[model samples]
Target: MTYRADPARYDSMQYRHSGRSGLKLPVISLGLWQNFGGTRDYPGAMEILGHAFDAGITHFDLANNYGPPAGSSEELFGQVMARDFRPYRDELIISTKAGYNMWPGPYGEFGSRKYLIASLDQSLKRMGLDYVDIFYSHRYDPNTPLEETVGALAQVVRQGKALYVGISSYPEAETREAHRILKQMGVATTIHQPSYSVLNRWIENDHTIDACGELGIGIIAFSPLAQGVLSGKYNSGAKEGTRAASSNTTLRASHVEPRVLEAVDKLGAIARARGQSMVQLALSWALRRKEMTSALVGVRTLDQLKDNLGVLNNLELSADEIAQIDEATKDGQMELHPSPKGWLR
Candidate 1:
């Protein structure tokens, strides 16, 4: 069947400026990191993608090393784009990244100029895209100089392989340095992707959020639900096929300890008082920051996507509510697992 998007898709969706750039991204962006790989059902993936667009999710976030075999997600996305989204290409924001172990060799990953450039070329090919709206250096590399990584990103823009450049998981100091270097190269760092949620607040402690605000860089928070811990799905314990139950997944059952579940339970009660689900509350909290351009979420089903989009309807939180959430999760240490590509898994 030919997929025709809902004409009124944009009626309720809110678009926010990406940093100081002229581009605006949907506040609730979709991420193709998990459950959209080769092993997953193509028809099911297409259904979720179609529903996301129908509900005004224009930004689709991806990375080169997303799938188990690596690059399979992009390949799947390419097929979906060719089949259903070809005509609406101009209406979407596609972004991909590099900086993880994509291939076996040393040249296949990291922040080096050679790796970034080649990886993006491969990513563009896999996605069947001429250029991604944003190309990110997926993570900071301590081995490479800041100049080299920023230069590679700038070159991608100059080559028309990417419209803008971004960095992910860089520390505050490194993020500042990257922004400075990119600005000197005549291309300002457009956005910064980070892992932030009620249970995981590293960005706040590291001051990355404050730095991005000062530098005019947009923040798109990944793992806003703390790998479903904040979603209240695991509050009772890991069920079948949940991230905690899946062997191939990064989020393990050990990570969700008693303390974490207790925190989640308290948070859930707070969410109920606000008349929202735990997922909605977590997402709304992540977007509470003015510097947050979007809250990038990953979903396996269309129902999950719709529930995430409900965050847009009620984003307001009183100061007291914020305090209650803080107190609830303060004792829990449920940070996302560290991966080569940061916490977007």
Candidate 2:
């Protein structure tokens, strides 16, 4: 069931510079953190992956612990690359991360040198690649020293296991320190993946945006749709058999609180005025930033991916529309410090 992509697929979306790097990443990137888990619908996942590539999505985000049964996502991704994408390796930008708990014991997780290095080696083996274009620390480790984590990332670049390094969920202060350390080690911190959306605006207050801008680090926003909250899918109430209704999910049934729903209703009205779906307006807002290199997104079906891709067609967000959205979500209905990684299940 392998698929081949058309050579002209690269012309679909406009590419943006990743920070100050020479690399040009597509505006919309694919992430394998959710639906790619082995236990999920495999045919659906592969179909969506093929569709994304055919639509000019060059970057794919992954991690060592991305499956319900950890490592299955990478294993399945390897099968995908081997069967369908092997020939297009040069045209792709593959990334994987380490930092979360992939295995038992102290050495198996965290920002320690031993853990980061070993996790990446295992990720490479699972994905059947010589090197990943970008490797990230899945999250910041408050317990570990910044120097140790940054040095481990530098070591990977030196070993040729990763071309560039990135950090995820790190604070602005930590980002600055990491950039300094990595630069001193002669390895640049090229990007940062953060959770940003019309519903979630923590990065604006956290200073990560300005810090990364100063350091020339690209920001690829994850969960830019606020896990589909801004999509108006839950506005009519949660449908059965959806990710929102899944009992095992961490998003919590309470996330759709009364205020959250009220905010969505108001936001939906604003989106209708612009003649776009709430999802499109939300995604467009995130990309309107001068420092945003890409918007990394995930989907359970090809239909969802298509709807998301429509954001690029109308990225124009008027000052008034942006103001309306800001006021609607001003109470901050999207701030959740919990790990969005359900694969650890």
Candidate 3:
């Protein structure tokens, strides 16, 4: 069956201008970080992609080290693009990143010019694209000179491999510096992908959100549902195949302590009162800021995708609701993952 996009798809989804750039991204973007990888479930992945496009999600985010085998996600995405997305390429915003541990040996990871350039080359080959809409440095590499990493990112744009550049999980100061460097190189930082959610409010406390606003860089929050914690799915316990229960996932059972579950339960009450699901409330909270360009979400099924898109139905959050959510999560701590160089702290 031929996949024809829904003609009225643009009628509902909201699109926002990315920073000061000419690019306009859907407020809710799809991320292929998980469940769209490996050899199995190829059809399942395709179905999810199809549904996302049909729902007017124009952005698809990926990274080099996303899959279990490291790069399988891009390979899988490549196959899906070749089959379904090739005709609609111009209407899509496809982004990929490097900077995590990929492949063996010294040059396989980090922000070196050598690694970034080579990684995107492999990514392009894997995704079967002449150029990606946006390319990113997955994380800040303290060991590598910021100049080298930023220079490599600028080079990618100049070489026609990527139209825009961005950084993820970088601190506020580093984000400013990266933006400055890219500006000097005649390229503006399109967006900053950060791990921001009600539970994970490091962006607020660390002033990364303020920094991005000051610098006129758009923010796309990943894990806005706090890796499903805020989705109200774990109010009782982790179900089988949930990220918290899966050994391969970053979210562990320990991360979902009783206190956090209590916080989530309270938040769920607020969502129900407002006539929305927990997932939709979490996403809307993330997008409450004007500086936010989009909220990147990953889903395993078509139903989940539809639920996430339902966020656009009511992005409005009253001041009292915000206060209630703050009070609910005030006691909760930001769950920090250990980075390799201890710089993420």
Q: Rate the local accuracy (lDDT) of all candidates.
A: 0.87, 0.84, 0.87
Which lDDT tens digits does candidate 2 get at residues 82-155? 87889899989999998888878889887999999999999999999999999998888778898999899999
lDDT of candidate 3 vs native? 0.87
Pairwise lDDT winner, candidates 1 and 3 = 1
Q: Tell me the tens digit of each residue's lDDT in model 1 across 205-282.
A: 878899999999999998888777788888776577677666668785545888888988998899899899899999
Ordering by lDDT = 1, 3, 2
Identify the runs in model 3 with alpha carbons over 4 angstroms from their true place: 335-345
Model 2 TM-score, all chains together: 0.94
Candidate 2 residues lying further than 4 Å off, grouped into runs, are 337-345
- My TM-score estimates for the predictions, one after another, are 0.96, 0.94, 0.96
Worst 10 residues of 1 by lDDT: 336-345
